[model samples]
Target chain A: METELSKRLGIEHAIFGFTPFPAVAAAISRAGGLGVLGAVRYTAPGDLARDLDWMQEHTGGRPYGLDVVMPAGKVEGVTEADVEAMIPEGHRRFVEELLTKHGVPPLPAGEASGWRITGWMEHVARSQLDVAFDYPIKLLANALGSPPADVVGRAHDRGVLVAALAGSAVHARRHAEAGIDIVVAQGYEAGGHTGEIASMVLTPEVVDAVGPLPVLAAGGIGSGEQIAAGLALGAQGVWLGSVWLTTTEADLHSRALTAKLLAAGSGDTVRSRALTGKPARQLRTEWTDAWDDPDGPGTLPMPLQGLLVAEAVSRIQKHGTEPLLGTPVGQIVGRMNSERSVRQVFDELTRGFERAVDRVQRIAGRSAS
Target chain B: METELSKRLGIEHAIFGFTPFPAVAAAISRAGGLGVLGAVRYTAPGDLARDLDWMQEHTGGRPYGLDVVMPAGKVEGVTEADVEAMIPEGHRRFVEELLTKHGVPPLPAGEASGWRITGWMEHVARSQLDVAFDYPIKLLANALGSPPADVVGRAHDRGVLVAALAGSAVHARRHAEAGIDIVVAQGYEAGGHTGEIASMVLTPEVVDAVGPLPVLAAGGIGSGEQIAAGLALGAQGVWLGSVWLTTTEADLHSRALTAKLLAAGSGDTVRSRALTGKPARQLRTEWTDAWDDPDGPGTLPMPLQGLLVAEAVSRIQKHGTEPLLGTPVGQIVGRMNSERSVRQVFDELTRGFERAVDRVQRIAGRSAS
Candidate 1:
């Protein structure tokens, strides 16, 4: 039960549960694993503070973490204004037109207007970081890239561990170089922005490459056996995301989308830039299909495309019943049909791990017998 | 332009490919594709001859295929006869001793003799159906699983096409149900026995779940446009086995397993059962650490485990360059340092296909302004 990662996170299990909702985070910590709240969707500082406060109260002093976005490489040399300027009138028109073509209605004028790319994204993300620091978050994670030095230093100052997601070993080294406490070797099979490496190869490679820095295997890992495999391959622990997305407490957008995810097999997802402007795996949907169309305007760079389409995403959640509007998830989402409580999910993983161990033992016994 | 697959077998594109190797039959012709030969390691007399002849002579004079297994897959499933029956007593004692001390190898061996499990493998695989079939071979492919049924049938019936190999999509369906003229949906990154499922989501989804089949799209797909995304996902062409495995009409093995693949990118290869019994993708190496570890046992079923350990495989090819022991391939194999000729490995496929008509039109005449 005492894993290297558990020692690092100062928790009983290295199970770092991520969720955008506070209730789920608190629940996971209550279930004995650390629940990390995602700050990506929090628009206001006060909103994050309130959520963290609630999580702290509910978790009963059990430790937890916080996740923020800090993209390593963005369109360089372009100021926020410049990025906004680069958003072509035609491109904006095209997105609007495409939405219309797809039966999505235009946003009412002046409803959340003047949303500039990069400008608001960085501001909102940093603000959430400030809010996160205000609480007793045990770990601070950057989902997109390495944390800014200030963020890392501030978290360390607050006695919080720092974790960063790395899509490749080179990225892993960058995080190590930046003095990160933990590195998440996320393969393409993971939800959200991920690279094209599988867990089997990436975990050990990252662990070896990082030279002792604790590496948590992410992507396509839902079962206890997969977690055990990660540990077998040198990962200190396994970081799960999609598995949480299908949990009973997850505040998923639609019942239909949830149903689709539950019904899907591991093979049904894809890594496409249509959602986040980076290759993040998710259930293939009509929205992604449009961007994938050979003849359509290719996906624009991050923030810009994301900004242009945020309202559409909001609307899709509001009304879209199609598979295309589902949020990011990993290939493992395929095996995530049944709804289980976060506690039940952990129990199932533990059972699966035991089964894997028993199976391997049996296989070895055959040669002896 | 008239290669064996084209001149003798007569298919629009002489290329043939499929997965689980067993389903090459309908996979090829269904899409007006050719099912190449597969299962060099396991070919029964009737299965091999029927597959080759059926594909070659059946495609209405259209070129079809042939694929021969040349030892690949990892986890050499070899044991001396005495060892096979009772673990040689010596090996058994060693294993038991190790288990008693270490609480069992990290992964135990299966409850069966590795040899016995694969006892019938070689007899069925090395049959060399190509020698018996009188039809001209348009293409040949090999990997895990048995070759497709119709691959031999259609080849002999029409004197036209043939095909083989596949990694995922119910391996059985690609040949049995999809009616693949030729089938293979190798991972985006795989060396052998693949099922890593990248090819941007296992091209063809095993060719639309095996219908109007005639797939090739093997692992990594090694080029821009890759026959224009294998005819934009409904692959009429695209077959690659470790683009890096050295190529020389004479030194195919030597040239294939060099250090070039070792230093390849994250996109390089995946671990899968195509090579060993278990799904595995790794750079080829003398240590062949993948299969040797008692912890993982790493091998899976069929010709893969046999192919990986076969004496003829690179272990003996170049004076035991352990690195060169297993098969090396996939889209990532494009890094293979040296190149060879089947007209330089069918110039149209290796290089020409990038600038082929369909590709040109995809990027043609876009307004730069």
Candidate 2:
């Protein structure tokens, strides 16, 4: 029952579960799929290292992956000082004002909660990468864009697969050209930063563009039938994000956020840069509303925008206020209501895949008869 | 320099456009945001005539409205006799034989040329109401379940505004409690049949369950600022279909049966059974891969399954020889690359609206700050 992707990742199924929670990632790996932990929310390399070590012990040496945000383009690649200087004072002031208005208390001087825009660029990424290398992670994925060649080469030298997220065929080609091992064709329906492309079209295009390279389809994939559809369209495996956000083990917001997500239909999500300074699909909320307001100051760029609002975002989450806390999810969230274990979700998917295969065969058999 | 939609229909902006030719609809409307046709593809009015007529004249009048098939529930209110009786004996034999051979053709009939599955439905729809009643149609819509009562009563009585299409939100709260002015919230993406809900969360939960009902957001809308992200959430106007098919003015394959719509993006389209008997989506091809496949003869009862493979379907469009012709469309079809003219394709929609607004605003000293 090993899937093509599972063979590549040395797992049983091609299912790759993405989560910010180490427990869920471990659950998926224990259940026979690769669970990849998202490292964006962590403030320090030590935090990521601790989580990876925990996953390693829990999964009993099952293969897993590490995901990092490697932005394709940035304002500057110069020294941290140079990049910080590039940040407009107005933008920084705007961030402060936004937090104050939102009633988020500033962090204590020694808290190290917020970093300036471009503050967490290469330096932080490289540190995290170093920590990840120490772990037994079988795969290393760049969540936002292509990993630097050196990073990919280093991972390859360690026998770790290097994967990158691609929103379009053009992006997929870039990953392939960079000698990446895998390309995750994430459609606009996916959570976090994404492009305006659907899975059906993007999957085949990326598969074609990358030629022999394996592609993992992401975004809006919840059921086995969709996974089957992705496979039919040429993806080797499915990369799921939103579905995990609703799982019983997920570290999701309280009842309010869950209710909103359950009640929402596919159209409820919007691709706004308000959260990540990149077009990421998220649950629409008043916070997003404020940023989208024409009169309100527009969103600042990456890291900086995130930095400015990190504390505010945390407070809102801690409070579990629906209007204040926005969750990053995809259109698939509309279909995610009931709480299930990662294993249960996997079983459903497998069942669905079997059904789809049976269905396709029945159709083909009837035609043949 | 007003758009044809604005000038002819006398609307404020040409921001609303719906059509089977999603590309034409998007191009004309997005260029100036004022082009709408009709979702003639799914309406069961006996072929696509009535729907087409409404789209033609309405968009012809002001570049507005798209009529489509939008079934609310799965195959409800249908009988075995109903399905069996609809297909001519000769056609049934042809379909059975075709199914016995290479599986059902990927498309119903219109994939290549001639009338398609909607052909009969279009004919029935044509007789149900007199589109001519709305002499100068501003917009046209359809409900997968049923057209709104007031929409029928008022539009016919006033000779203005055409409405059709509805799915979910309790069928748009009974078309906004029968006051239906223009409520089309179709999901499933695009193409023939739809459902499976994915209009980015069913177009703002059917605009908060049809408040002040002036919505026209269909499945798979294409473009960056389509109605802007604002309009998409609860749009006053945003309707799209498969934006992949050839336009009336573009050259199409005469033999390749399946319309190359399956290759479309999230912005491409969806599939549903409002057209035939089951919910399915695929490129209209010689083999109706999603429907006629024997493994899942599980097509929901429609005008019964007989309507699923009506004789007219096969004759309407053949594969590998004639692909230019297919039936219906969703907003995703905006991807189709070509152009046409509903009064030169509403030149004003693409150019005139902005210029006219600019002139008026300049005169009023209200230019942007």
* Best model per lDDT: 2
* Predictions' DockQ, in order: 0.04, 0.05
Best by DockQ: 2
Single-chain TM-score of chain A, each candidate:
0.91, 0.90
Candidate 2 C-alpha lDDT tens digits along B1-369: 222223445554434554445346545543544555444433443333444453454343444444434333334465445656665565455456655464335555344433334423533344434543343444555645555454356555764555555556667787666555666666655454555455544555666677665655565544322222213144455454444244453233442433343333334333544236656454444444434444534354556553545543544344432322245555345344344443343442224223322322222223411
lDDT of model 1, residue B133: 50
Model 2 chain A lDDT-worst window of ten: A360-369
Candidate 2 runs further than 4 Å off: A72-120, A253-264, A363-369, B1-145, B148-244, B247-369
Model 1 chain B weakest 10-residue run by lDDT: B360-369
User: What tens digits encode model 2's per-residue C-alpha lDDT throughout A1-369?
Assistant: 244556767887788888888989999899888999877666677877788878878997899998887765655656655545656787667666766677766555566443223324766777888888998899898987788888888999999998899998888998898899999999767888887666544665687689789888787688765665455455678899888877888867577777777777665777888876777889887788877776777787765566556666665665565666678888877668788888899898776655544433222222110
Q: For each candidate, C-alpha RMSD in Å?
A: 21.0, 20.7
